[model samples]
Every structure is written in structure tokens, then in C-alpha cells.
Target: MFNYHTLYAELLSSLHGSPLEKWLPLLPEQINQGLCEQRFGDLADWRQVLQQLPEVSANKIELKDKIQIDGDSSDNTRAQIKNLLQALIPWRKGPFFIHGTHIDTEWRSDWKWDRVLPHLAPLENRTILDVGCGSGYHCWRMLGEGASRIIGIDPSPRFVVQFYAVKHFIQGGYHGVPPVDVLPIGIEAVPQNLQAFDTTFSMGVFYHRRAPMDHLRELKATLRQGGQLVLETLLIEGGLGEVLVPEGRYAKMNNVWFLPTADTMISWMRKCGFKNPRLVDSATTTLQEQRQTEWMTYHSLEQFLDPADHRKTIEGHPAPLRGVFVAEV
Candidate 1:
């Protein structure tokens, strides 16, 4: 059996005696269910990849500027590390450097981080929840910013294993477990009205939820009073009350349901009882920001867009214009 006893224990241990202690009873089952082989046929293969990772100790770890692990390693060992990591292809949210190998992922998640970081309240000693945090790239960055604890959740089993693959090097290099983890679950698994975290991040997720209001409420429920909510999602340019409800697919993504204007999103946040809601940054995603790479050999933003007109998606909807919003509950 593919067991994650240590991972589960770490999460439960961190929540023990904390405000999130109530979550303990529910997590073990959820984690097991999320990783069940019947649910993810490739689970065994992914687990094997994790086990195959070269036993390398990082001499230096840098996450403040980028996800990098530098260790005195020979060329052969670096090549071995690269091969093991390649099994988890389509890496969407990182540009991690391990030893001498650069796993340049599809998205330059660091660029997005740069835009969102300046607007965030100081992360020092904060407890954070990152929703849809694929592979926990930004979770490490949050820890780098001095967060006391961080739990990033995503449903993809592939992403879960990818996170642990990186964690293998990170934890192996250190004396103790870092206060960061990625759970193989979704936001729905989170206890309602837990009000536990100091800050909650729901990036690139709002538009996918069929019920945007419910999603907003769920995000708010995770935070304690006066806690901050940082959200980033696709948007259209329009006034309040205007939203783009895609009839079919948008940007080759079928799950996308709603793309609201910045004003509309703020209004939605207000309706969910969030206070002081405001747009912090807005920018269109570019080919340079997300594209096919050696590590992520899959079609990306360029293929999703209209080749003749970069302003629109192939399906004729407006191209991805993302907005970052911050509010307090």
C-alpha cells in the first residue's frame, strides 16, 4: 500500500491544540480517499518516482526569491534527480532548481507571486491556507516569507506526489520537518466555518466553481476575524453587475464558468461579508508567462489562444485577463 503516515501525522500534529484541532478527525480518511488507487490509477507509479529520487542533501535552500536547492552533487547524481522528476510531467506551477537541474515549469509562478506579494500583508508568523495550490510552489514561498504554518490543498493526485518529490529533498536537507505541506484534497474537504487561518489564498479557482458565492463564502469561512483573503482569477473588463458566463469553453478550459469584472468580483466579495475589498493588481497572462517547456511538454496559453488574434481565445472569448483582489473578514 502507498502509505503517507508521516505526512498525515505531520498535518495532524500541527493542528493539534491549535484552532484547527477540530480538523484532525476528518483528515486521515480524506487523505486516504484522495490517494486511493482506484481513484488515481497512476498513484503507484507516482509513488515509485518519489522513492526513486536520488538521496541528495541540499547544502543551501533558497525560497525567498525562487524554489532552489543547491547541493554538492556530481553530474551523474544531478542527471538521476532530473530523470525521476520528469515522470511527473505537465508541471504547471513552478520553476524549481534542484541541484544543477532547472525544472522550468509551464507557468512562471514566480512572476505571479511577484505581482501578488507586494499587496499582501506581511506573512511573518502567519498561518495560511492556499486553495488550488498546485504542487505547493507558493506554499514554500509563503514559508520563505516567515509564515508559521501553511497547508496547501489540491485534488490532483499527480500534484500531491509532485509536492512530496520536492519535499523529499527539502526535508532531507534539514534537521526537522518544515511547517508547510500539500494535502491531496479540495476546498470542500475543509471544515466549514473553521475560522482558523490568519490568511487564505484562493488563486485561479473562483471561476471554476459553479457557485461563485458559495466559493467566496467557503474562503471566508477559513479565515479568523480580521484575517485577509487574497484571490486571483480571470476577469473581463466591465462595470459592476457584468460577468462573462461562458456558454461552452474558455481558453480551451471546459470547467471555467464565470469571469467577472474586477468591480463585479469586489461586489461579490462584499456580498459574502468580506470587508475593505479592493483590486490590488490586474494583468493579462502572456505567452512568456505560461508556455510549453522542457519539463512541461504540453500545450499551454499559446495553444489555447487564437493564433490570428492574441486578444481572444480560440473559442472567441476574451483572453485570460487576471485580477488580484484582497479583502479582510
Candidate 2:
């Protein structure tokens, strides 16, 4: 087993009297529901990998520019660490270096972070909520920038396990476990209108929601009064009021619902009562930023695009162009 009881204990002790204390009563049951074996058959296999990871104390821990952990493990132990981490494949959000292994994920998530970090309010001492944070890569980066605490939410058990794999080394390397956690639950599981965090981030998640306006409202509710909202999502080049409701799959993703213009999204934020919503950064996702790596050997952005035209997806929709917006609640 992966010893989820320990995770629960740490979260309870750390959050007992914090601004997020109210969540302590509900976390255990929610975490259990998210990790039920019947729902995820591979959970046991992933747990076994975690059990088998070599115990090595990291000599250096760096999370500022990259997630790098260096230790004095013997070469044999480093090889074993690499093999164990390989079992958790299709890594999506990181390029974490542990001991001597580089687990380069499909998305060069660091590039996305570089684009968004400069435009936001300072993260120092801020309490943050990262919705749909896969493997908690950005959560670690937030901690590096001096966040008081960070809570990441995602429903996938695989990503949750991957986070703990890196976190294990962090605990061994640092004096104590840092105040960062990735809960195996979605944003919907959070108590509504709690308004606790200083900053709320919803990145690469807005288009997947069937109800776009509701998603904005949900992001708003997670923030304290006058808190900042950092939202990054798919966008199409068009005027105000223009939106793309893909007839079928967009970039071979079936669940994507709405791709809006930058102006349209800003208008929607205003309607949801966000203040001074403005487009901060906008760019087309390139092959270099997202591609197949040895760690993530699956179809990626290259295969999803039209063979004849790089600007269009195979289904003739505009290729993915994402935008980041900052607002105040």
C-alpha cells in the first residue's frame, strides 16, 4: 500500500488551525473516495512502485527554475530509482530530476510557468489553490517563490502517486515536509464559497468544463475577497462574442467544450463579478513545448495537428492557441 493514512495525518496536523481548517473534517473521506481500488484498477500497481523506491537522502533540493534533487546515492541505487519511476509512465506535467534520472514529461510545463509567472501578483506568503494541478509540478514551483501554503486538486490517482514519489525525496532532503499537498480530488469536492486562498489558479482546465460560466464562478469562490485569479485556457482569434463550440473533437480531445476569444473570456469574467480582468499572455502552443518523450511515449501535439497544415488541427479547427488572464475577485 502507499500509506495514504500518513498523508491524511500530515494534512490534518498541518491544516488543523490554518485558514483552511474547515476542510480538515472532510478530507479523509474525500481522499478515500478518490483512491478507491475498485474505481482505479492500477492503483495497486502504482502503490507497489512507491513501496519499492530506493530510500536516498537528497543532498540538494532546487525548485526555483527546475525541480532538481541531487543526492549521493550509489550508481546502482540511482538506476533502481529510475526503473521504479519508469513504472509510472505517461508523465504529463514535469521534467523532474531525481538523484540522476530525468523524467521529462510530455508538456514542458516549465515554459507555461515562465509565461504566466511574470504577469501575476507576487506569490510570496500567499495561500494558493491550484485546480487541475497534474502531479503538483507548479505547486512545488509556487512553494519556491515563497508561498505560505499550496493545495493542488486533481482527480487522477496516477498523478497523485507521482506527486508523492517526488515528495518522498523532498521529505528526506529537507528539514521537514513543506506545507504543500496535492489532494486526489477535483475542484467540485471543495466546500463552496469558502473564500480562503489569496490566489486561485485554473490553468489548462477551462475548456474541459461543460458549463464555462460555472467554472469561472467556482474559481472565483475559492479566493478570498480581493484575491487574484490566474486563468489559462484555449482561445481562438476572433472578435468579442465569438466562441468556438467544436462540432467534434478539438485537437483529438473529445471532452473540450468551448474555445472562446480573449475578449469574450474577459467579458465573461466581468459578468461573474471579477474586477479589472485583462489578458496578460497569449501564444500558440508549439511542438517544442509539447512532444513525445521517452518517459511519455504517446501521441502528442504533433500527431494531433493536420499533416498538411500546422496551423490547423486534423479536424480543421484552429490549432491550440492558449491565453492567460489575470483578474481580482
**Each prediction's RMSD to truth:** 0.9, 0.9
Tens-digit per-residue lDDT, 1-329, candidate 1: 45776666777887889999998898888888988888789998988898788788888998899999878888999889888888898788899998877889999999999999999999999999999999999999999999999999999999988998888888767768888888888999999999999999999999999999999999999999999999999999999999999998999889999899999999999999999999999999999999999888878999999999999999999999999999999
What's the lDDT for residue 289 in model 2? 91
What's model 2's overall lDDT? 0.92
Q: Candidate 1: which stretches are off by over 4 Å?
A: none
RMSD of 2: 0.9
**Candidate 1, 57: how far from true, in Å?**
1.2
The true-versus-predicted C-alpha distance at residue 134 of model 2, in Å, is 0.5
Q: Write down the worst ten-residue block by lDDT for model 2.
A: 1-10
Instruction: Report the number of backbone clashes for model 2.
Output: 0
Candidate 1: pairs in clash: none
